[model samples]
Target: MALPAASVQLYSLAKEFTADPQGSLDRLAAIGLKNVEAFDFVRRPAEIRSALDASGLVSPTGHAPLLTDELWTPDGSIPTPAPEVVFEAAAAIGIQTVIDPFVAPERWLTEEGVADIAERLNSAAEKAATFGLNVGYHNHAQEFVASFGDHTAYERFVSLTDERVQLELDLFWALTGGQDVPALVSRLGDRLTAVHVKDGIVPASNPWAPGAEAFGSDSLDQRHAGTGEVPLAAALRAGSAIQYAVIEYDRAPGDVFADIEASLGFLREGGFVA
Candidate 1:
């Protein structure tokens, strides 16, 4: 099969997007992107749909909260809407997968907490299926904080959840969690449906902490793709089942659009995305 289309997480340019969602997308289109991983689209499906139609880009996947009471971000949080409402909005906007971008760090600390996270998502997945939408989870480094036997909380959650609950691994965060990133991708197999392709120089004293620092830099230095310490090529080589290689950054290293273009070049030239 052809590799999945390259995508850019809109959150990588969250500020510019919030200011001009249409303009931000226009820039992406100019960069040759055909897909995007949307954030904060639950409350404005019609508006987003219109914008997407105008831009000629499709958002097959998007981020919204299904487990939490509120969706948190560095900018702010949006109150979590009912799953039925979320599904309705997603359907209206032509989203195929509704991946919960985050759950609190503490939720991954204990076996019981991880179990609840899985159970709740499994229930959500069942509900989402009714709308012809798939549910998934995106990881931050925090999920690796606590270990349950040989596996971490993330792995345990993987075991507890139904197979339909897809995964979108953030490669940079996985590295921050001190994981052998490529090996983890191979191990995840078909369950891994997407990856947030990122690069950065990780700090020396990294630890498996129970919070969002593992998601991105607390003190690490961000870099353009292929220039950072992350073995992005190796990780992508292992993602045999990955559907969307989303270019992202918690804090952009330079001219955001130019930075994204560089990563896109890396993915395309390296044949990581079709």
Candidate 2:
């Protein structure tokens, strides 16, 4: 199937965005990006909107860090608007979804805990609905690893969250968690609002397998989309029903722009997207 015009997560280039938001957006736009998924804890919606407009890109969704105790801490918080403010911003930006990228550490386990998180998400979804936007949870490997004995915490979330709540599956993380991306997508169906398109490989060197980097540098775990071990084409096929597929790389080997450009080339020519 031919892929739609692609969008990228701005956080992947946080260094550049921080140094020069306007220049970074322009550079990305020049690289053929029609849309962007921005992440800035300090920048307001108005500031983002102005920058995006200047760069000739639109944001159909925003990365709203999930509400958790960790977010109350310094390093994890994103400047989320108040519910009313978020609604107003969504209305102005034409954003349909707000993706919460990480579950707070304290909130990642147990049936009751999962239920509590679901209730919170459901409430957010409800509030967002009033603004014509939806709330979604974005996953990481932790979600897949944190399990309730038999089922993974991710499974718990999927099973418990209200139908209105959506998911933004990160295919690479799904594989890292040892879950079947296609199966999960099939199960979730329309509940999947968007996806993060990237690739991962079974590490041959295993940087962190035994005695590796002092802090365990397993950078090989993540690679540019379509260039690693993940079955990206298959994943994309499964997400055909989704509304958006945003390209991302948590760590770029060298140039962030080059990584994104190469991934885009692969996505367009490798049959994941047109």
Candidate 3:
């Protein structure tokens, strides 16, 4: 199979990017990246598009909230925008697939909740098509916290969502949830269009599990790709139709740009991306 293209989630350098969008993107371009996965871009699509264009980079996929009333992060919650609004913004930024980055942990714990999440994303996908865009979902460890009989909530979610909805799995989070990362990638098969190339020491416990204390990105022990515990190479190899291997860090281990470069180096040296 052909290798996927290397991309970075702009969230990896959110602070720097927020401070200097164009300069940050230019630095990524200097590192030889041709593609990026935008984050929190719905509010300023035109500015981001201009920056990406100036940097000679393209954002084929981006993150936005679609299935939730309000988007939650470890830090705070952002009010969710309407799907039509999201699609319009994504199209403006040249994003082909708008992926919802998170759904609350409690929402992934039951049959009905998982079904609702899938149904909402499926509907969003239909609406997004009108704007010449597609919609997808990204998972955190929360998706694996509950199972209905033999299937994980994540598995059931995949089965419920339409084919048009894509999946972007975070390998480190999957491992944190006690999954065999490469095996899950194989099962996801062609639908897995992207993988978050994040590597880190697995947290001692599932932080999203019920009763766990609140935590933020600063608490993560993330490392450059292949330097941590995640089976990134095996997971990348297992993907049958992966198109973008996106490097991300909830928290960078060092200078953010250098950290991103190190992960990009891993992808290049390991022959995981084109």
Give the top-scoring candidate (lDDT). Answer: 3
List, residue by residue over 183-209, the lDDT tens digit for candidate 2: 877777778867888876743432212
Order of candidate numbers by lDDT, starting with the best: 3, 1, 2
Clashing pairs in 1: 141-214
Evaluate all candidate structures by whole-model CA lDDT and list the values in order. Answer: 0.88, 0.72, 0.94
Flag regions of model 3 displaced more than 4 Å: none
Off by over 4 Å in 2: 1-4, 69-81, 148-150, 202-221
Best candidate per TM-score, number? Answer: 3
lDDT of 1 at 165: 94
Instruction: Give model 1's TM-score versus the native structure.
Output: 0.94
Per-model TM-score, in order, reads: 0.94, 0.85, 0.99
1 against 2, candidate with superior TM-score: 1
RMSD of each: 2.1, 3.9, 0.7
Candidate 3: lDDT of 209?
98
Q: Indicate the TM-score of model 3.
A: 0.99
lDDT by residue (tens digit), candidate 3, 1-274: 7899999999889889999999999999999999999999989999999999999999999999998888887767889889898889999999999999999999999999999999989899889989999888899999999999999999999999999899999899999999999999999998999999999898999999999988998899999999999999999999999999999999999999999999999999999999
